[model samples]
Structures are given as C-alpha cells and as structure tokens.
Target: MRVLFTVYPNSLAHLYPVVPLAWALQSAGHEVRIAAHHSSAELITKTGLTPVLLGDPDQPPVRLTDDCAPPHHQDIVNRYADVMGLSPEGREHWIVFYQWLMQPTSDYVRLDRSEAEDLIEFARVWKPDLISWDATIPAAAVAAKVCGAAHTRLLIGHDMFGWSLDRLAENESALKAAGLDPNPLATLIRPLAAKYGYEVDDELLVGQWSIETMLEGLRLPTSTKKLPMRHVPYVDPEPFPKWLYERPEATRCECCGRKNRRRVALSLGESTRRFIKGDWDRAPKIIKALGELDDLEIVATLDKAQLADVEEIPPNVKVIDWVNLPHLLPTCSALIHHGGIGTYSSAVAHKVPQLVCDVEGVSLLMRLVEDGDVNKTGTYRLGWEFDEREEGAPDAATAHWELPAKKVESTVVSDFVISTGAGVRLDHRATTVEEIRDLVWSVATNPCYRHAAAALHDDWLAMPSPSDVIPDLEKLVVQHRR
Candidate 1:
C-alpha cells in the first residue's frame, strides 16, 4: 500500500513526530511519501522518506490577519469551554491558550488555495491508500476525501483540535440554541471542500481516526478513536563532537575535586532556539545561577545567538550549539528546559528528572495580538504572584503586567511530572534565579525524583514502539480505506 504523510511547513517540530512511524511502514514493505510545503523538501529527504512538495518554495508564507481571527475564535473557544463546563482555572489552563492557538487554523490562515489544490491533484494522481497528516492540516483531510483514501491525524501532543470538535458535536442542542453551527471545523473547511465538489463532513475534518504519541495519562477528553504509540526521538543526524566523549574532569583540575557534582542538560527546546530571536533574558540568568553550584556541571544546548546577552560564560557550564537529546540525556542527572514535547518525551524516555519552565506568557500575548493589540508587547519576566484577597484585577506593575500562569501543553506535561513526583514545574513568571537554582538542585539530588522518573520510564516503555504498531496501523487502513 502507498501511504502519504503531510504536515504544516511551519517547523520541523511537526514533521519529526511522524518520521519513525513512516519508517516503520517502509520497513514493513509499504511505499511512503511525505508531502509538505516545498520549503521542507530537504528535511523530508533527511528523514529517508520520499518527498512530495505541495507549494512553490518562493511563495510568501500564508498568514492570518488580526481582523479575521479574534471574534470568531473567541466565540468558538467560549462555546467549547461552556460545553466542557470548565472552571475558571481550567479555562486559564487550556481554553485561553487554545483561543490563541486557534489563529493558525482560523479562516484567515491556511494552505494557499493553489497549494491545497496542488495537494488534491497529487492525491488524485498518486491514489494513495492512506494519508496521515499532522493534526494542524485540515486540507489534507479534504485531499484524502477527494481521493477516496483513509486518513488519520498524527498528533505530536494533546488532541485539542479533536477535543474541540468532539465538544461541539456532543453539545449540538446547546449550539443550535445559541444560533451557531455545531461543526466549526467543517465550517472552516467548507470553502476548500466545496472547491473539490464535496460537502464538508466530520471525517474530513477529524479523520477516520488518529495516531497519538502521548501516554494515556496525558490525553485530553476527546471522543476521537486514537491509537497510542511510544514516541521515538528523532533529530537530524549530527556527528558526535570529540569533546562530548571526553570527561571534563580530565581537562581541569577543578572538576577532579568535585566528584559528587552531577551533570544537568539545560535547553530552551527547539521552538525557542529556532523561532525566538535574541536570547531569552532568562536563559543566561538561569545558566549562570545554576552554574554557581559547586556540585554541578551544566551542559547547555544553546547557540551563540541565545548566549549573546551573557557577559561571561561560567567555568562549570559547557554551551554547545546542538547535541541529540537521546545521546546526551542518558548521561545527565536532570533536565531543565522549556516544556516542548520533544524535550519532555526525551527526558522521560531516558529517565531523567526535569524542571520545566514558563511558556504561557507568550500565548497570552498572542491573544492580545489576535484581538488587535499588536503594538502591546513586553519583555517576559519571571516571578510574580497575585494575592487573591486583593483581586478584582491588579494594576500593571511592569510592562505587560498580566502574564498567563500556564500554557495548555506545558501545564499538562508539568502537572503530570508533579503528579508522578518525577520533577518540578516552575509555574511562576517571576521566579528568581536563586529559586531556580534550588529547584534544579532538589530534582537532581533527590532520589525520589529519580525513582519517579524510572516509574514514568517504565510506563513509556510499555507502549507499542513504531515497529510494534505496524500491524495495527495496517489493520486500520484496511478497515477504513475505500
């Protein structure tokens, strides 16, 4: 059977999750091709899969405007929250973040009509047996429908999109009462679907089913039938640097005396490293403060761009541009990182304790931008708390005073870490360097964190690996394909 894979071309983060499974299908003698924007052709080739380019490499990237997003996005979010009966804090944790997330899939932003037509034309010519796409790409669903192919979303994290669509369906009466269409996903896809001479439907929007890498415990409340698989970490292959294997103690007399010192992997995750320009002011501060510990060696996976603000490199810290997490994580005592699924899953797979930091503030600002407040921006700071007793709302203490305390993905992962006793979640935006130092030390030295991490590792190991789940995927394709 021929299988076609598709993902949004915005980043490799979306592409990486599906590679292992694509490889698994290929190993089982199926033909597989990855279709993405032309910009990602090189990356697709790097994964050892055939590439199907969908759009012109020179085309300006698709973008959404503020005028197009806010009102409709907020309405859908509010309705979904109402149907879910979320609490105030629950709304903050997920719904608010999702409102900001809705921009990407909004009516404004999507694959160019020409690019999408390109995909549909390819599907027609290729007649793929199945189309597995990133959850963010609804146009692939349209192509699958037009081509009579089975389709499923390949989720890298939580199933927020699926969950929202499910909520809308389950509360059809309430939505109708409110004078709204229950199937917002279908509504969003209608313009494109109509072009293909088909009416929009749930199967095209949500897929016949989905494949997810998140453990069952981390899953959201969604009615979509999903198959769970263990996340296999894959990075663009890089040659090992000679210094990586050499023990630091051999080169410096100072390191030889601190035999008790532990090694910690410090990274801001790929999204931050690739997308965030300039250093996050907090990165240098955290590295320097953690470096002050006499009993630690910090391996910071950061490039020169991220370290531009640092006046001095700490003697105990080794800053490198890149190192594969699967290679370096096993040697580390703990991980301190932005809560990207790639980094979080790598640490869990390697049984390393973790300290996950703030990701919500940026999402909060995203809400402001979508609401047409583009000029309102602030430097993200750590360590503020609101006194509940004094609240209606607090006055601005600094630039962009109201920062979100949580982002949906980070909060979910961090909560699981805390619940399992495997790590700590640094929730405060205003957390001090001293506080971070203590948290890092606690998770690294505490055997409880190690035991908890091992337990989590055992759970992760129990999930079916890519190669192990090949039969299930084949069965599903057989069952769902026309």
Candidate 2:
C-alpha cells in the first residue's frame, strides 16, 4: 500500500504526531511519503520518511505579519453570534478563536496556493492508497479527494477541526435563520475543491476517518469515525547529558537536617519560544518559586531567550536550553509545563505528575486582562505587567488554557490531568510565587500523584500502539478508498 502524509509547514508540532504511524506503515511493507513545504524537507527526512516537497526550496517560506485582524472581522463574528442567540461568553469565544487561531490559520494555509497545488499534483502522480493529513492542514483532504485516495486526519491533541464541524452543525439552524453560511470554514476551501471539479463537503472538510491520539477521556464529542492510537513522542535525537543519569544530591532542610530531594523537570515548551516571541510572563517567577523548594531539584529546559528577564538562577535549579523530553522524563518525579502536548504526553508516558500553568477563565477577554486593569491580546504579555490583580478582583479561575491549544484543547488536557489526580493546574494570573513553589513541592513529594500518574499511564498503554493499529488502518483504507 502507498501511504502519503501531509503536514503543515514550518512547525514540527504538526509533523511529529505522524512519524510513529509512518514508521509503522513502512515497517509493514507499505510505501510512506510525507508531503510538506520545501522548507520542511529536512525535517521529514530526519524522521526516516520519504519527502514529497510541495514548493520550490529556493524561495523563502511565507511569513505572515503578526497584526490584529481588521475591526470588521469582529463585527461579522458578533453578527453571527447575535443572530444565533449566543451568550456573551459564546460570542467572545468566537471572536477570540476567529481572530487569534481560526482566521489566521485559514489565511496562512491559503497564502501559499502553490504548496497545495503541488501536493495535489503529487498525490495524483504517486497514487497513494491512503493519505493521513495533519488535522491543521485541511487542504490535504482536498488533495486526497482529487487523487481518489482514502484520507484520515492525524491529530496529536484534541480534535479541534472535528469538534468545530460538530459545533457548526449544532448552530446550523441559527445560522440559516440568520441567512449566514453554516460552514464558513468549508467556504475557505471551496475554491480549491472547485478547481478540481469537486465540491467542499464533510468528507473533504474532515476526512473519511481520523486517527485520534488524544486519550479517550480527554476527547471532545465529534461525528467523525475515529481510530484511537497511543501518542508515542518522536523528538529529535540529542546526546544525553551525563548528569541526567546522576541522582540529584540531598539538600539541607530547615526543619529536617537533610532530605533527599525529588527532581522536577520544568519545560515551558517550544511554541512560546519560537512563535509567541517570549515565554509566559510568569515563567521566571515559577522557576524562582520552584527553586526555593529545598527538597526539590528542578531541571528546567529553558532557553536563554526565556530566561532573559531572570536576575539569578537558584542553586537548586539547573537550566538548560534543550533536552529530548523523553530522555529526561524517566528520571523526574514531576513535570511542570505550559500544557504543550509533547510535554504533556511525555509526562504521561513516564508516569511523571505534571504541573500545567494554564491561564484560567472562560472569557478570552477576562483571561488576557493585565491585573484586571487593561486588556492584553497576547498571552506572553498577560503575566508580564502584573502578577496580581487589584485587591478585590476575583482570583483568576484555575489555569485552564494557553496559546496554541486555546480553550477547548487546554481545558480537555487540564481536566484530564486533574481528574486523574496526576497533577495540578495553576492560574498564571492568580498564582503567586509562593503558591507555585508549594504546588511543585506537593506534586513531587506526594505519593498520590504518582499513583494517579501510573494509572494514567496504564490507560495510555491500553490504547493501541502505532504498530498495533496497522491492521485497522489497512481495513479502513480498503473500506474507504475509491
């Protein structure tokens, strides 16, 4: 069988999820090729997969300016909400996602028309029996359709695309009553579909089926048929630091003469460093707070850019620029992160309790407020200006979501983590340095968190491994392909 995978350009977040599955297919005697922007050819090859480059390697990848959407974008979203009788909260959700994530992604994917055209042309020539597309790049569905190949969405996190389609259907009546398009997202790709004498529909918008990696409990309700698979992280190889194997030395405790310290891994993740221009504003504060815990040795995977604002590194904390998470996770007692799926999954796999610093609040506007005084659009700025709100402002709700994941994605992960008793979520706005310090200490020393993490790991293991899913995928391809 010929299997082709399509991933969004630039970010490996979209690509890494597919690697283990591609390897599984290749090992099963199937030809697997990953289609991505020419800029991503090297990344694809690093995974030991054949590269199907989508554009000329000579030209620089497209760079979209970071700017607010026009005011009219909000007006249209508001109009849709008003027509649909959505609450202020629901309306704001639309505005926040439409402006920050949805619209920007649509624009980004559509900007490089040549990339999509190239992928479609390759699918035609290669004649792959199946296409597994990154959920973010729905254009791959069109390519699959044009080439008559069975397609499925490959997701590393929550099924936002499928969930959005479900949401659109629920709002169909309200939208039709308002004389608005029920599926604005579908409209975005209709032109591409039309170019090949096809119409944008559910199959083209979602896929024939989806290979879902999120643990079942954390998944949102969606109509798409899903093939559940375990999330096996595939990070770039890095030489292990010798010290990583050595146990952290016991530290003197004020009350107890000396105590063996537990090791905690602090990784805020790559999205903030590469795309957001800065780590979460409260990151330095969290590090310093964690550093104060004498019974915990913190190994922070923070780059110099993220540590630019820090005045001093605590003696208990060793900060490094990068380490493959899977390499460090096994030795750690607890993991503190910004809710990046890679970090979250690694912690789960290693049965390490996690401390996720997700910003809290249902309202996007409320979460972005700086000290409850001014609205700040960027998350990197939320904790930068002030750590606490004016004395009377309601304490920020438990940290729920952060960038990239948005509300739906972050909420699912946090809810699962908390429900499984595996870790705690700290509100970036409301948590003080002391609170963070105590939380990290509790997660590391507490046996209950470890037990819960073990249980969670058991659940993860129960899911089918990538290789285990080969037969099911083969059946799916046979059932769905033209």
Candidate 3:
C-alpha cells in the first residue's frame, strides 16, 4: 500500500505520533511519505522520511485569519457546548484551550481552499492507498475525498476533538427530542466537505478509524473507531555523549553507590519564556528557589532570555539551554514543566512524577476574561491567571484571584496532573517561590505520586506496539477504501 501522512506542520509534538506508524508500515513493505507545509520540511527530512511540501513557506501556515481566529472556528465549539448544556467554565475550557489544541484541524485556520487545492493535486498524482493525518488537519479529509483515498486520524494527546464531536451529536439529538432546532456543529465543519461534494460525518474529524497513544482509562469519551498503540518515546536517534548516562554520584562508595541525593528535572517549555511576551518566564525564579533544596540536585533546561535574569547559578542546580527529554527524564525523580503532551508523555513513559506550572501556548483562542486586567487577550488558562489581581467569577465559576484554585484547573492542568494521577497542579499565581520549593521537595521525596505514575506507565506498556497494529491498519485500508 502507498500511504500519505499529513499534518499542519507547526508542531513536532503533533507530527511525531504518526512517525512510528509510518515506520511500521514502511518496514512492512508499504510505501510511506509525509506531506506537510514547507515550515516543517527540515524537521521531517531530519527524521529521514520523504516529505511532500504542500505550500510555500512565505505564506502563513493557515492562509486566512481575522484579528483573532475566523468566526466559524468559535461557532463549532459554541454550538457543541450550547446543545450539550455545558457549563460556562466547560464552554471556556473547550473554546479557549481544548479546541485550540486541535490547531492543525482548526477548520478556519488550516483549511483555506488553497492548501486544500494543493493537497488534492498531490493526492491525485501520488495516488496513495491511505491518507493518515494528525487529528486536527481536516483538509486531509477533503483531499482524501477528492482523490478517492482512505484516511485515518493519528492522535497526539487526548481525543478532545473526537470527544467534542461526539457530544455535539448527542446534544443535537437531545435538542431534536425537545422540539428545539438542533445546533448543528456541521455548520462549522461542512464548508470544506461540501466544497468537495461530500456531506460531513464523524469521519471528517475523527477519521474512518483513529490511532491513539494515551492510556485507555485516561482517554476522553469518544464514539470513534479508536485503537491503542504503545507509545515508543520519540527521541533523537543520534547517540548522546557518554557523560549524560552516568549518575551524578556514580563514583561514590562501592557499598551503596549512593545516589546523588535524588535528581529532579526542571524544564519549562518554550512557551513559558516566549509566550505572553515574557511575563510568565518562571525559569530563573523557579531555579533560584529550587536551589534552596540543599539535599537535591536539579537539572534545568532554560532559554537565553531566562538565563539572563539569574544573578547566581545555585550549586545544586545545573542550567543548560537544552537536553533531550527522553535522556534527562529517566535519570530524575520528578519533572517540573509546562503541561505539553511531549513532556507529559515522556514523564509517563519514564514513570516520573510532574509539577505542571501552567498551560499556555497550547491553544490559540482568546476569550473575554472578565476578571483579569487583560480582559480580552489572555490566550489560555495560564496566560491570564498570572495576573495577581484577577477576581473569581461566580457566573463562570472560575478562580478570579486564584485561577488554578478557583477555576476547574484549566484543560491542560487536569490532563497533565490530575487525570494522570502523577502530580499536583498549582495556581502558580497564588503559589509562592517558597511554596514551589516545598512542593517540589515533597513530590520528589514522597513515594505515593511515583506509585501512581508507575501504575499508569504499566498500563501504557501493556498496549500493542506499532508493528502489532500494522495488520489492523492494512485491514482498515481495504475496508474503508473509496
């Protein structure tokens, strides 16, 4: 079979999930190549996969946008929430964060007619047997329908897209039962499908079948044909220098070979330093505070902007710009990071406890925040909560003064910390440096969180490997072929 893998091209986090499957299919004697926008060309090439670049790098990855997102994007989530009777906090979480995480498939953002036209042109020429896309890039569905290829959605994190679409259908059914006109999510979903002369259905977003790496018990509810694949932690294939593999105290006495007083991994994601124009760059402050933990060794990954602000590098803390997380995480007792799928998945694979500081930059939607001073521009739950004076809102039932405390701990917070049962969530706004120091020390010293993380890792390890699913995927291609 000839397979075409498609993605929105902005995030490697989204792209990596599909690579293992691609490799599995390729090794099984199928032809495989990745199709993405030009921005992702270098990364895809480095992975040693063939790439079909869809558009010029000069244009915005998604061609059309307004002051914020295109109107219909919000319409999809809004209609789903309204028909489902979701609470305001629920609505905001879906709209501002969860829905935004599905960026590649952001109908208005990723699917202008031009990108669709480009994809279909390639599909017509390539004549692939299957077209598998990352969860958000609905344009691939259009290309598949036009070119007569079978397709599937390869998921990166939670199936929030599938879960939301399922609720949309159920809610519409309930609305119909009550004699109210159904709020058709299809309104926002159908433009591209209709443009290609097909009506929308569950497969438009979720695909004919889908592949997910998250553990079964932790998945959001979905009605799609979902399959589990054991997550193989994706890392740089190039070998690391020998020094990184040695434990800090590997040279200690032979009797005990005493560990270096428990090592902790401290890494705030790229967004923490660059997002919000640097207002939430907590790396320096956090490192300085964690430095106070005299008995522990800290390995922190920080950016140049964050490195500039620190007056002293603590004896117990090591600050470098970057290290492969797969290499760093397993050596550590715990992780402190932005709640990205990459870090969370790595932590899960290594059975390391985490401290999710805040979730920003995962989504692109902005909301009218009534309590924060920004009111109109705070992009995600963590973006606005950094404001010290934000007041809790009764109408929304979100923390005003203490967002992590008041609101439902934001989408990414629950996804990374609470849902996984691996670590504590902090309202970073209310959590002081000393408090963070204490919390990090406790999570690192305590064994309960590690036990929970281990159980979750065990479940993940029990799932089928990518090669194990190749036969299933081949069978699906034969069944779903146009």
TM-score of each: 0.84, 0.86, 0.80
Off by over 4 Å in 3: 63-83, 87-93, 96-113, 173-185, 249-259, 271-274, 279-281, 305-312, 358-365, 368-421
Candidate 3 per-residue lDDT over residues 1-482, each given as its tens digit? 99999876655666776778888888899999898877678888877788888775676455222222322244455665676787654565556334455432453323443566677789989889999987656777777877778898887776767766655566766767655445334545577677677887666766888887777665666788887887776754667856468765433435777644778898766443432323243555677778898777888887665565567789888887778888888778899876666777788889999887664323334333435543222233321222221424222323111112111223455454667678976436666889888998888878988998898788878899899998888888888887
Instruction: Report the C-alpha lDDT of model 2 over 206-277, residue by residue, as the tens digit.
Output: 788888888878776688988999999888776788887888886667787776678889887665565333
Model 1, residue 443: distance off in Å is 1.2
Write candidate 1's Cα lDDT for 5-87 as tens digits. Answer: 88776467788888889999998999999987776788888878888887666753343111224322445666666766666
Best by TM-score: 2
The global C-alpha lDDT for each of the candidates, from Candidate 1 onward, is: 0.71, 0.73, 0.67
Q: Best-fitting candidate, measured by lDDT? A: 2
Candidate 1: regions farther than 4 A off: 63-85, 89-98, 106-112, 179-181, 247-258, 273-275, 278-281, 308-311, 359-365, 369-408, 428-430
Task: Kindly state the number of residue pairs that clash in model 3.
Answer: 8
What is the full ranking by lDDT, best candidate first? 2, 1, 3
**Residue 234 C-alpha lDDT in model 2:** 86
lDDT of 3 at 288: 70
